[model samples]
Target: MPTIVRASVALLALGLVVAPDALALSKRDQAAVEALNQQMQAAEARYRDAMVKIANADPAGNADVDGALEDMEDVMAACAKQKGCSPTTMLTAYKRLLKQNADAAAGEETPDDGADDGASLAADVPEAARAAALLSADGQRFVKMVQYNPAVQAGIRRWLTDMRGPLIDTYENYQYMRQLMWPQFERAGLPEALLFGVMAKESNGKVHATSRAGAAGPLQFMYATGRRFGIGPDATGFDTRYDPRSSAQAAAEYFNERLGQLNQSIELSLAAYNGGEGRAQRVYNSTGGRNFWDESVYNQFPAETRDYVPMVIAAAWLFLHPKEYGLTFPKVDAKPALLRLSRPSSIYELTICMGNGGTRDGYMRALRNLNPRYQAESWLPAGTTLSATTRMVGLYNRWCLQGQRAELASTLVRSNASSAIVRTGPVTPLPAEDAEIEGGGVGAAGAVTTSPSVSKAKSKPAKPTSYTVQRGETLTAIARKFQCDTGDLAKANKLKAPRFAIRPGQKLKLTGCEG
Candidate 1:
């Protein structure tokens, strides 16, 4: 079988202990090799960054990509030419130096840098990323035993007390979306507990969660990382990074890709996922392909990562055996179904009508999870069929059709500023004589009149000549939003009729129509 080399998260842990061949290098040769190694690292970083930039672009364009590629070519050529400087050797050296730099720079206790690691705190790591399965093995037992460790015990205590609400929220949210997200892991032969652990830690199963560094979705994928794994804006302008199924697939593929290259340690795969893949691989390789839990390997990554691995393990264990920790996961009725709207309504309206009747907490999150493509307040046209839960269908039948609750929902949703922000004063009555219309016009009586200029101006405002597709926008929705003909908008953008696909950052012209 062919090895899968991923765009990101490759080339870190060679997983082989470097033993010198019969030909050993002198001190001078070693120094020269180190110098060349640094050069190779610089070139690789530059190339990787450029590729990431291009991947995140609308049409995969990057001006610096060519230059970076050329530099990599030169570096690789240099490596192949030099007797002591192979690509693997160079990368190993880079990893060693990187760890040295990180260790030197990181204080005994550095503040959590959530930007790179995608998580925070060793204190919370135990419970953040956790999962469990029916596996019975020494490794599984070790993972379970980790929950009783002092560090993990702190996390469990926090979960049972201070962090209880957030933990419950994540669990509930995960259950609703598990059907859509878990299959990817199962198909990939990855653990479901791991998925829950990462989901809980990353975005707490919130599909719309966005980080300051532009990571989004249930798994919180950064744009560049997501693009590498087929997660990006769709033709309808919905970012696939925020889609549960797609993001889960991407995350699974990414983990597998790292697994193929690294020491095959889940901790290392996660390290690459949190800290860069190349960095994780390098650390693994530098240490002769040893365990990630080793003091040398553990301290090499950021403090955040050190905590992340253990925490994820703990979370996974708890997910598997919540009862052991005196925690009970709430039962959810999440059987899938399609809900065809009998009347035009938004998720907000539907949620209001559904009430808190069936479930303890309402169906807002359940509704959102089942239909991730649509926003909560987006109005769906009547008869629009959406992915939903059977419970939702039951709730809809009972409350949202045309009863007092339905009427109240519609009224509440439709109550606009115009009606609510009423005129405080009494209504102004028109003059007995007809009011004169402005714009240099005379009427038969005191009636309002319009000039040719005013008449021309009174026509509906001219539509914008162009539009840039924003995230979550669709051709049909955009046409409706601007009151333009859908066909014209599609044609203007040279889009096909039935399925007019558009991507975010794409521009479209207003052709042969007015809004």
Candidate 2:
């Protein structure tokens, strides 16, 4: 009875669309409105059941979602034309359904067993910040609508061909951090494949990858943007943008908001992700929300974004159907485990002691990725716990807990290059070519003598006029290393203020730096 009363009120409120006298339905029209409402209710129930199946990864879920959504849409359209039915009432019911789904999804996001504390990142995520089920009607529609044009096909080609190695690497890396990262997206009802696609394209799954524009983390959130989404520097001076879990959560929140604005268009939302949201919104508005693939809409975006949307889609598609393209992603044993350090050790030291354990490279990358707060070289105290895999924990116990290999690893890491070289007498110059030879013998004084350039001129080697940026190096770090004024160094390289953004291997003028 309350539902009927609400429908009557909606019809009365929507009188602007019809004559006020026509607000009251005749007996036959009343029957039609009630029938439409029943159809909508049945569709909503089916959608809820399908969402549960989807969360559990059931194949039948997709078909159920499609059918339910079609039913709802059909009812809504019929309601719009029905004399006594109100489209506004139908729209309100649809919104209520989405809100219910969102709330349910958010409630189901309990902390994983491996979480360090009860107040885990998943637990901390606000309900409103999470999205409705990706397998729900709207999300399924977006998935069904994604186009595989030539641009996307080209992206697939690149991923399967030249970028194949990177794609494989991304999958491997994502596996190790999947527990920490994927849950964030999952809780938001985002597709896991989309997360991988973005991570693959953005950073090759490198957690600390920072772009020239100062975007950081696996999701590559720019600093300002990261701040808006509750991801910034913590009190410990660690930027959460470099954190896989937090960054993934922030990225999900970003896409959730963008998709809401872009009428659930994945291409447009992705374009917003890469290009500025303001630019994406303007284009959407000017085109009256046309399809993103439309020439008029597609051409308006920058070259980078135009490439980015399809590439992401292609990567996601490959993620969904890797075997279809004859690509087999390596299987990884990613069961979460914790490693409590038996003694103080660096990640580099752990890597040496951990050995290959059947992996091509050791656990160095995994260690860095899982425990992003600490650098590879930064020593952790004894009993310090680290997020690790079962395999890594097993390796640590076998090889790293105060055994011969553990001692050897510790010695190797502690052995300094400077300490290895001993000077006992005045340096004697040698031929440049000879100086470059490896393993030159110690001098008569039982110390290694300088092989090159005891340059008698001693005019201080000419200050380098230019420098190539190195990985993980920031402008401030470079300034400190080169003893240059930060402002002057930025100006010399024409870098912008605040961010002083620079990418690895970017060339910069060393004009303001000293020898």
Q: What lDDT is obtained when candidate 1 is compared to the true structure?
A: 0.66
Q: Write the per-residue lDDT of candidate 2 for residues 258-358, one digit (tens) a residue.
A: 87677667899999999999999999999999989999999999999999999999888898888899999988888999999877777888999999999
Model 2 residue 190 CA deviation (Å) reads 1.3
- Model 1 residue 50 lDDT score: 51
C-alpha positional error of residue 387 in candidate 1 after TM-score superposition, expressed in Å: 1.2
The most accurate candidate by lDDT is: 2
Q: Any runs in candidate 1 off by more than 4 Å, and if so which?
A: 1-148, 417-419, 424-515
Clashes of each: 15, 0
Model 1 alpha-carbon miss at residue 361, Å? 2.1
Q: Positional deviation of 485 in candidate 2, in angstroms?
A: 32
TM-score of model 2 (CA atoms): 0.61
* Shift in Å, residue 187, candidate 2: 1.6
Runs of candidate 2 exceeding 4 Å displacement: 1-143, 428-515
- Model 1, position 185: C-alpha lDDT score: 72
